[model samples]
Target: MKQSNFTTWFKSGSPWVWMNAGAVAIAVIMTLGLLILIAVRGLSHFWPADIVEAEYTIPGQPAITLLGEVTTREQVPTERLQGAGLPVDPEQNEFMDRELLKVGNRDLYGADFRWIVADWLSNERYPEDVIAIERREWGNFYGYLLSVSHDGEVVAEGEQAIDALQAAVERASGIYDEIHSLETGAIGKINTELERLRLRERGYELDNALTADRQAELEAERAVQNARYAELESELVDLYREFNRDSIMTRAMDGQEKRISLSAIVRVFQPNAMGITDKIGHYFAKLWEFVSDEPREANTEGGVFPAIFGTVLMVLLMSIIVTPFGVLAAVYLREYAKQGFVTRTIRIAVNNLAGVPSIVYGVFGLGFFIYFLGGNIDQLFFREALPSPTLGTGGMLWASLTLALLTVPVVIVATEEGLTRIPRSLREGSLALGATKAETLWKVILPMSSPAMMTGLILAVARAAGEVAPLMLVGVVKLAPTLPLNANYPYLHLDQKFMHLGFHIYDVGFQSPNVEAARPLVYATALLLVGVIASLNFAAVAIRNHLREKYKALEN
Candidate 1:
């Protein structure tokens, strides 16, 4: 039959193909753009930005010099500036350009950020002598190194002070590491052992078997731990004394001098003078520190190692729980059950469960997992730890279980689809070879469906990792005193609370006292969370691909 040009094009399907491809390309671009924005905002926070020294003048106010990094710049209406108590030139223009300076002498200025109209800034300079100091507390300090002192005596000055201060800082950092290890390692170990002994004594009391011999043994072990702790305490004291012996004197841009103890300093660098290579090295170092070190300064600064660890641990726990149960349910429904009304109703319920609000699951988790199941567990196994509510509290175990329940529907549906695809010939052939239905399902059907199982798992991991509301109610906390996994007895303590990267980002973005300082950290944390979830999914994808390849011949 003869056709018009439009009819011919429609029949070719080329237009639809092009439209689909364009839609996919746009989606890819948007996703990449978002990731690039996050990377730029978060990763740049680690780079040592050149510190600028500038003289700022405002009407009827004395000219003041400023030193620090230019953190933000934008244009604002002249009226807005006037409303904010800044003198604005009305005759000049409707809008005024402004810069926010991270003037890091927080101890002196009472704030880290300051805004000044760009027009009033003069004598802008990046001096090679200017140094930026990252302290253990009170944030950063930007100035010139005037001298390095030891025991209240000037040991080096001017150019020579840089080398001396670097050496002293290195030594102090080593001492700090030792002290940290002693506190969180040796002492932490001793404390865990002491706690175990206490719990053990309690257990014996509950059993009415508190024998004198057992008590004496525990006391003897505790005495040894005490002696070790005493020795470590003495060593820590010596380290602190050594660490505090050296300090640096720096001159602010306003010619004010301040002494900062070397022990309080985390790092010092000449950002204005740093070459590209130096900045790159410093950037990677800072990035590593952000991921490896424990958070400090109310979690607005430092690394989020605990959060990362907790997230991976909880997801792994959830995966372990959800996989078998999901597979079993799918097998029962798809393979064994008769096609009937009850089965159809059950399938509809499972599908509906997937659409339920996540916060509802959280409420269910708090009530059932924490209150009912946990209460019973505490009564049965941890009666001595009552009043304190050991297992009957929000914790990693309940959180993992709650997420498992939330994600099980996805896994069940995926597995059922896989089961239905395994040509009836294969199952019948297995049974024809003297195998029972259960045997054929176990060794044949399940192996062929492994790829689909992994697909479901990947989806579950992605969803569970990003879920914050449910975890907040079940287990996640602002800060966890100890990680779920540690070097203590029963290394994996599922009963303990844990930190999550999602919660960290939310808290730092909204709940932080220092909003300006925490803003960069929020972007960095969000990037890290995305990277973690991607890595997990990639691993699952690899396994899925391998399973698909292995089972391809069987299907054929």
Candidate 2:
């Protein structure tokens, strides 16, 4: 009787329903758990962790002074520690506490991080005067301030040293900012103009139209550009001199004294002395810099603004190119094409294309769009830039076009589904009112299908924004400091390579020289990429919902 009751429940589908619900619940829990883990590990990278100084000892070695921020803690098997040639007493405990410390001053030690056995550490202390210095290069420096100097003379020391050092840093930083502005701004403009002039001259020379007077005119323009460049160069020299006029002396954990030029230092803060409010403020400041500044230190440091900008721009360009073409194709397939085997075969092919590997699309883009089509265009219009392959190279324009092609099938399928959903009575009613089929499609059919088109776009963007494989071949680069859009004429430079968050994460996570340093950043960049894609999809979904509501009456 009990067995029969169990069989009855299974046959009634109750057990199946319960199983499905359990699967769904488990999936949701796993997804949320992963996201939470990523958030905690990634976002904490920028927090102001208190610096700890301790005396580290081993069973057979003398103690060494260690100063660093505690990055992470974990438990290791005692056997694993002993296997690594560490003296671990397996009898004491089966597991051992292991801690990772970010010991800075890479120039001195040649390593930024070290894993130490926690059981051997003693005399842990947090000193208020110990400062952490963020530098433009060589990672970071952790030490105590010794003195401040101007040029080669000691200008401030003792009690007034920190205050004097801060003032000097501010001055040096201001000069550095000016020098940066000159390099990327004014000097950059000059470089662009020079390239344009050279290209123009090359075109004229290639066409055999370079008369003596024309040659002289080009030479005169070149001379003027050179003069401007010289003036800027002289100004830059002065700025560099002032920028390097100050320096700070510091004492490291090993009691070794080092002098760091203020020009190379980005910021100095005593993290252990910082209050809660100060740490919070510092965290936000670091976060903002990560979002707003250009990358530095081999794409590991600074902000990813360029990647964010390029990803958005490429997606926008793809949307603009794909929408009209996909809609027209869908219109032809569903409304104009005859309901025969040919149309059926074409629809089958389109659906199959959607499942093709993304890397395959990347290869297609590289071969056809860049090598064949782009090379031909460069040959026809940019003959003077031959061999240089201006348009023939992988660039943002080709990347956008490649993505448009890859996603157009999705749009076609979506729009076709939307077209099929519209009632035939609506078309008949429009025709009865003397409207042509074209007019009916434009005014009635297309409006009702608008939501589906947006759905296609959202899907396309969601997939494309996180795509690293295709973009690596087409346009995305490991580093692209200069943005595509600028104040220069022909404002948008589509032929230039750009950065993407997806590729940035791959490069940081897999190719970085610093493993531990890049781990948290891998999480952070992954989170940022997800956020960016989500933001784009959310906007599209909102539009889709609005369109659906607006066309509800027509659909009914």
Candidate 3:
């Protein structure tokens, strides 16, 4: 009767236990799966290749090849280009000297061949001048055409008119400056007089007849000063009229330069949806150029290689910082320290710190590390760099230190758990064999617990890799032209600001004026970061399983 009762009770509790276990397993699996998806999507944005044509013609200049083949605008109908949805600026045609043509839509302006010609008068006066052009297309192109020339009479008249206008502006500016200086002096005198009047009013409290007649004379002088100041202000306004006088007068001097209409040029190269696809291909090609070349401007054909290098370097530095400190703390707490009130209190403090918001850490790091410790270090070791701030500033080293602090608890918790799982007999046996405590820990305890140590490191790394808030206050920048590591003197300067992937995503998404276009890139970068963390975790797990299997016989 007793055996039957025990069997019934065990069966009833089994279902509940199995249900809880299954739910936990499912949750873990789903989390890992999400991470893998994000990583895959992000890495794919850098891959893919495509092509499109860029076309433009000079004003009053027939399109002729170096080989002497004349291609009239009439021969190539604007409809061919329009069907392709090529970009055309009617305003550019109305105001500028030369017609402009680009490979694709203006919104996709960064991905193609962009051309512009300054108006005729400015063109000759600044002979080496080149109009701003952008090639914001995806793929490579086979052919490019540009015509540059101007009629002699139109060019000469435009140049003469611009010169006359510039002379007039210079003369007006001189007059404006003189009047402005005089007005400023007059205003200052008026203010002085007003202050005197105020002091005189205070004197009235002591005496009734204190300079009443003198005060009236000063007020009259102040009114005259005010009138002169207004006159000068009016003269300054008239100076602006001289600024655009050249352009306006030139238009009246010579009819607007004879130019091919950009709209007419677009009608020549138009393509269908196939053309759009082709242009997207060209866009990718242009993007590749940017990725492979050195940086030119903030927005230009250049690679993000420096940023990538800086991000990886910073993360690696942070890992180096966090790992040893975290692992040591965990080892001490789990193996050496007794479970007393103080130890328990310390553990609670660590857990609470882990839950504290990241931004708070940023502020703390900025104040304590950058201002205090760095300032002290500079004062002691770098006395020559006094007041210039050796350590009292943001840089790669401080950033790493800040992130290390943020990730310490994560590593400590992971390591402590791993240490707890080692059977107590292993330590007892080492001691029985006459091995010293230090030797036992170095030879057996650490080696045995290494897989768990690695697991903790992996978890810490995953968290640190994506952290942005603390980094912002420490040293991460939106754009870093050169990486922290370089072939210059002091190859690795810890004081320099570095770029990071998480910060890059924020910059491209929120800071860019072209947010709509940058959206895809943001998604791609996010995916890459997720993938990197997931891959590291997977490797750690693999190592853990291998260690478990290798130690199986010893456990027995």
Which parts of model 3 have CA positions greater than 4 angstroms off?
Answer: 1-144, 147-302, 538-550
List model 1 lDDT by residue over 299-395, tens digit each: 8778999999999999999999999999999999998899899999999999999999989999999999999999999999887777788878999
Per-candidate TM vs. native? 0.96, 0.97, 0.56
Cα lDDT tens digits for candidate 2, 191-241: 988888888889999999988998899899989989999999999999998
Off by over 4 Å in 2: 1-12
Candidate 3 lDDT over residue span 197-251, tens digit each: 5555545534565576766765676677667667756665554443223221111
Model 3, position 469, has a per-residue lDDT of 86
Question: What is the lDDT ranking, best to worst?
Answer: 1, 2, 3
